[model samples]
Target chain A: MATKILIVDDSKLARMSVSKLLTSLRPDWTRFEAASADEAIILTGREHPDVILLDFNMPGTSGLELAAQLRQSHPHIPVAVISANIQVEIVERAQEAGATFLAKPLTSPALAAFLDEAQARLSVTRPSVR
Target chain B: MNEFLEQFLIESRELIAQATDDLLALEHAPKDAARLDSAFRAFHTLKGAAGIMDFDAMGLVTHATEDVLSTLRAGDRAVTPKLVNNCLACLDQITAWLVAMEESEALPEEADADAAGLIARLIPSPRPEQPAPVPAANPGEPTLPAHAAAILQEQIEVLALPQDEGTPGRTAAAMRVMQNIFTRFGLSAPAAPTEPATEDTARPQRMDMARIETLVNLAGELIVVKNAYGHAVSLAPSPALTKLQAQLDRLTADMLRGVLAARVLPLRHVFQRFPRLVREMAASLDKPVRLVTEGDATEADKRIVETLFEPLLHVLRNAVDHGIEPPGQRAAAGKPSPAIIRLSAARQSDEVVIEIADDGRGIDPAAIRATAAKRNLATPEALAAMPEPELLELIFAPGFSTAGAVTNISGRGVGMDAVRAAITQLGGRVTLHSTLGTGTTIRFHLPFTIMLTRVLTVEAGGQAFGIPFEAVVETQQFNRKDIAAFGAAEAIIWRGKTVPLISLAATLNLPDTPPAGIIHTVIVEHGGEWGAIRVDRFGDQLELMLKPLDGLLSGMQGIAGTALLGDGRVLIVLELNEVLK
Candidate 1:
């Protein structure tokens, strides 16, 4: 089965750029987009994407809070928090939630590395499916 | 332009508008935390967008602005007029950059200098009592511990192989490696958690104005085709054909209404910018004035809403510079300080009525009379005999200025006359009412829409043309002897008044066949004056979707636009006002 990825950001341009880069790196991966934490939560439940990429700073709820929540409910799924200027506190909190931190503008190499790790984890955790 | 760049420009403009609104509101209520937060978010998002686009200068400037906003948000700095002005100025620069980017479809060159200047202004100066704080490390570089770093490297290799079964064993294997790494640092592992979700699937698509305009044009063409169909059915009338024609007429009317409504926009688009303008103007003129707008939600055709800004700006300038009295004078006149300029709009019947009322020294009829005489606009006896209302009307005459000395704001020769001319061109009328000591009110009575025009077709010099029905007062036939020649001009008596009579064919330089006995004349009104146009014959009345001439004939005077007649012929519509002038 092909892997699925969910991208969340308030800025449509940012979301589009990430999707475009992800497509170039992993053309077989299916991509789902959300513009807010609330939307991301709903999409995660419905799409069951294998990996999730989120923006750190949003209007109502920060991505850190959402990442923490998603980690509790879907521990097997890998999540990455992406932001332009990643502060130390945000990175620590992301780590505590077992989520990866990636700096933006997201280059292909960093995203590919994360995807490689995510794929490895999925294969080990879901060997029956494989 | 590429999609990302186009989206950036659109989103940047929206953020700028949002930030401007918040900043302007903050000027009135400095303690409004919500507005401050909103403004901060807009700047933060703009900064992030700039960073994504690799616009280093814009990112740097917005970052500086965000720092100041953060200080304000933290309650460390108080909002001040200078702060608001600097923010607004920064937004103005960003607006300029966005415009350049839109034109060039690339990052603006030479933005570094402008961004540096704006950043300098955005960074507030430290007070003498407080010392400048040390700069922190760049947030982009976060320091990580060795063990935590090991997990990032170890996880890649630990999860590299696929297991056939024993999912629990594999999970334990991954956790055991993390546990062993944590044991080396004498630390514990963290646990994870999740939740339920609600669904919302309301997604609205945004349509650009050009696409909407294309739809409007198509709707207009459909109207023309429907009219042609109706005409064809009329030539050979049958019960069935008549029924089909009626059905087609109703459907076309409904679609046209919908299309035109799509072209209608709220007057708020034009009115929202006035409060800030009035604030700046009041500060500069040293006159305390408040701009209060009402009925901003009233909608009008997009063209009307857009074009209204210029004429309204002229009126507002006049109201601020000449209409509103200074604070001292206002108090001496037993009026409250900070004079009010009210801009209100409403839809009445088929017209949109906009009124700009100012509470200040109104136009003095005697002063207007003196100015008219001084400027030699009329004879002294004529000025003296003019009614008070007629004397006040002199303020709108060309080159008329009642200001004792020229002011930079309103008295550089473009006066109320220009305002009147602009309104007139938009198929609107401007009327002014002023009470000597009380105040002045200017009202604009404008048409609902300019799309579908009702024209009366006429044949002149063997060519068919259209005259806007609103301009035609009445048409009549008179004997050639009734026209009396005065030197090079001719005059005719109509309704007990002498109106100018001109041959339309001759005016247009077309071949003219003089009337042998009786001549067909169309009496027209333009700018409160009357004129009669002579035509070869009068034709049918038509409701046409008038398209303004473009390219070579864009600015051609006396021709308003072209329209298609029901019988598949092109009709040239005349701008009677321009023709008469």
Candidate 2:
């Protein structure tokens, strides 16, 4: 089956962007979308999605902390944070929390290429990632 | 600020000042309906003003603020200090916008965040439902007024679309007809009702912020390319062979000027907020200070005016807080109880001179000396020997204060140093003169803008170097006959007492020493003293575009920034005073 991924963001524009990017980058991939952390976690438990892309500045728990929680709950799944509030400390904290970070406003080409490389590596190391 | 946003900044500043004054007056009477009405009017005017300026982004934010003010004015709520403070915070964000606009016509990080906060506060918080509608006031106005924002935005958009081009026309016209009806009632036009229209609304076309930054970066890169090409032409065999080469050079220079002019903003934008600021400060302190301004009509290189705002504000604040004593104190000193602060500007030769002066309690030389002693800043001997101007200048010194205790307003050490640093960064000079209890005047003479600077080129250690021409006090020839040595340090008696002298070559650690002949000495003054710099050769000065040194290269002492000579030779512009320090 196609690689399954989850996208989470509170902003309609941001969520739509990540959804469009994932669908266009990997047409064969299955994508699930959620607006908040609680939804992402519930969906993660249900679908066991390979990779989760998170937003940082949501109303409730930020994307980085949510990714950290997901890592603790589902140790095998890899979480990535995509955010616009890119400060030096936030980048450092994201790295320490064990999630790959992508700065926003993400260019489509860069997002597309990043997914291609990431999916290939996941297929080799963790077939369960996708 | 760009011409448009600058117009926005100035008008908003005036509204804020008027609003602050009216609110403060209300505080005295507490039941003055007329005063409250005027205050409400100020907010409404500011909202409408923001719309008129086509600064819809900020107008919407102000519009939301106006809603809360309008609601409160209807006897729905009372004005408190907390509300005033929120309004002040909103003013501050707008102030930040001026600064950002000065540098780039961009907002400072989330230009819209404050507006959102202000709007959120205006919409009464969810509480145990009251019979009517009202809410608790907060510490600051939202950076924006979201309530009026939608209405103002639609109005501005309609206005901005140009009278002829505003019709969204066929398909989309029918689409937004419902939104147009809903939004006319001062409601937020929802992003989209369905997915299909949502896609259309998502496509925004008015040059994105990234695109503006990219344009600037490309322009900057083009200059680099132009300079490199010129360098190649200079090195080519038969350099003067054809008119094509010179024509290409002139064309490139013209293009660079055009690019720079694209960013040229008027000084009135930077000055616009000050008149209101002066009025507010005068009203707050009850000092009756009138702001007399000149040169509001002069044009400045845009970036220069932008950076000038903070330092100028800091100086103006000091004038209001400490420079002008209270009415009783001023009268006691035989000066006018109502102090007049004059902010005047003029183009002196090629530089712009801005003077902020007040006729009140000037920088007291005795107080400065005492403060210097308390801070243990200057030696007893140094204090005794220093000139009055030098003593008055001590206010800018780090950690030196004359105040007996720290007040939120004046005793802070950031007063003059920040001003000096900012002006110096823009290749400028600031000088101060004060009469004991009479008054003080601080003049900042700066290049009309950033980018180009006039510099003195001097040769030392077989290398050519540049330093800001303003740093040079005078240049003279020094022989053993003209100079005499003092203990440990050398000195030259110019007026009476000997001034300290240092060999520039020795100071900068250059290889070339003064030849057996008479050495050319350049006297540069920094802070409040003069020092002589020795050089092997001094050449004609140059006006060149200086490229700022990277943080790594910036830490190098005695160097300000670097500039490339027309021949492509890189030279360092020295800050002589920094070296002496």
Q: Report the lDDT tens digits of candidate 1 across residue range B1-581.
A: 89988888778877776787788889878999989989988888898889779999889888888888889989899999888877876676576666557667888775675575566557635742222322325564443354345454655554565764533333433443343334333344443100000000000113366777898899898989988987898899999999988898888878877887778777876776677677767876789888888998898888888788878878997899888998888888899877999999999987999999999899988878878888999999999899887788787887786445676566556778888877876778899999877899999988877678888999998899998898899989999889888888898998898988978898888999988999999999865768999999998777789887888767887888888877888899997766685
Reference-based lDDT, each prediction: 0.79, 0.65
Q: Per-residue lDDT of B56-163 in model 2, one digit per residue for the tens?
A: 546666666666666667778677755654554455445444444445555444446445544554464686232332232553432223343443454445434543
Best by DockQ: 1
> DockQ scores for all the models shown?
0.39, 0.01
Measured by lDDT, the strongest candidate is 1
Candidate 1, TM-score vs. the true structure?
0.74
Work out the TM-score per prediction. Answer: 0.74, 0.53
For model 2 the local lDDT of residue B510 reads: 73
